[model samples]
Target: MTASMTSPDTARIAAITLTFLLAGTVKGVTGMGLPTVAMGVLGTLMLPAEAAALLILPSLVTNVWQLLAGPRLGALVRRFWLMMTGIVIGTVAAASFIAGSGGVWATTGLGAALTLYAASGLLSWHFTVPPRHERRLSPVIGVVTGLVTGATGVFVVPAVPYLQALDLKKEDLVQALGLSFTVSTVALAIGLARASAFTTTDLTSSLLAVVPALLGMWAGQRIRGHISPATFRRWFFFCMLALGLQLLLRHLI
Candidate 1:
């Protein structure tokens, strides 16, 4: 469906704006959630493709910030190059499959991923990757992340957990996620373009949506100065759990 197929009313416009703001704030605080949260909310108001379309610019912009804010970019890239390559390849290969499966598949896949992610976070579950496995596992995890992103327009599953398992320093870890997410967003854009899900109207709306995201990111950063991110992170995951349930219900019903 095109933007012309679903004209945005005042309610949808407002919903979209607020959703991006909230998603961006979460990203600012935790270096994640712009895509997951935005899609969770926006999917309710529009076609899943349209909601995914709206994510392009905001995901790219916010994730760029997340990517660049950390230290030693060159070193990080060197470390994760094989994983990055696999992400690109997996996304490109799976895009057409997702397009054929239709949006319902994407929605369900995203919901399942969010449910698993939130449940894991809520349980405070952690995995440790043995040093021997890191070499073999990184590319596999990267490929999995790319496949999920290709289908769902959300990319915070095995990838995030895999990164956490590495036990990186706080700064390094944040930057690593940023880099992975940045790559994911770029790959998603390519996939959407090939699928013809991203149109000019969506691009315009996506660009316009960037304002709220940046403002929300700023606000979240300010809030970070005042409150503990641990609290925010807990709430964020719970909120994801709710959104995941909603998505599942919508699709199942």
Candidate 2:
């Protein structure tokens, strides 16, 4: 690999670190959102493929922490089995596809999709597909999520809104995110391995960067308790919309 491609410059490293710190803080405070925030910001600096690879380890670690910290892990697991299954299948398919053909197209598409979703959330415009006889929307969501996860390394968008629509309890939402990430990360790692994207250097860099991720998560957790849920949701959706639009514009141009 060429120096420019393999060895990210100091500015890039600095940007990644700062972004992760912010992501960690948001996730810690809200119980989830690190990848969405980080991916959107980092896409401006690095290739989408690189950003996805960089986030793998940090996302894995943070989700692990979230999963273990919860009190009713087993119950949450049971409640969201259908959702989890969809995420797993969808993520694996997406990851495999991207591993073979990673580029701006995937990133741009992901950004556009996220922007639309975030805008809907911010505007309080909900899209509901009625469950007709023999409907299978849950697995479809899972498959789409997996595909997106494979392509962009961001799987939360597909599942999050659907879960929210269900009006699941707060803890249930958190647990579902945790479970989805864990499964998606595992699929991502395998896909990366097959693609030969995980260099020794990449692994080292990811390890070194873990500190910032942890710090951000801790910071987020501390502030999360103070904010009302409605306010948090509003800010989060706004941020997602802004980031998604920024990425889409950058890639399109």
* Index of the highest-lDDT prediction: 1
RMSD of each: 3.1, 3.7
All candidates' lDDT scores? 0.83, 0.75
lDDT for each residue of candidate 1 in 83-153, tens digit (9 for 90 to 100): 88778777766665555555577677767878888999999999998878988998998898888878777
Runs in model 2 with CA error above 4 Å?
Answer: 1-8, 100-102, 125-135, 226-229, 251-253
Pairs with backbone N, CA or C atoms under 3 Å apart (clashes), candidate 1 = none
lDDT of 2 by residue, 1-253 (tens): 6777756676777888898998888888777778877778877676666777788888889998878776788887766667677777666656655555756676786688669768877888655545451136777777777778778777676777776666656776677678878777777776676677666777777766678999998877787788786788798889889878877787567
lDDT for model 2 comes to: 0.75
**C-alpha TM-score for every candidate:** 0.93, 0.85
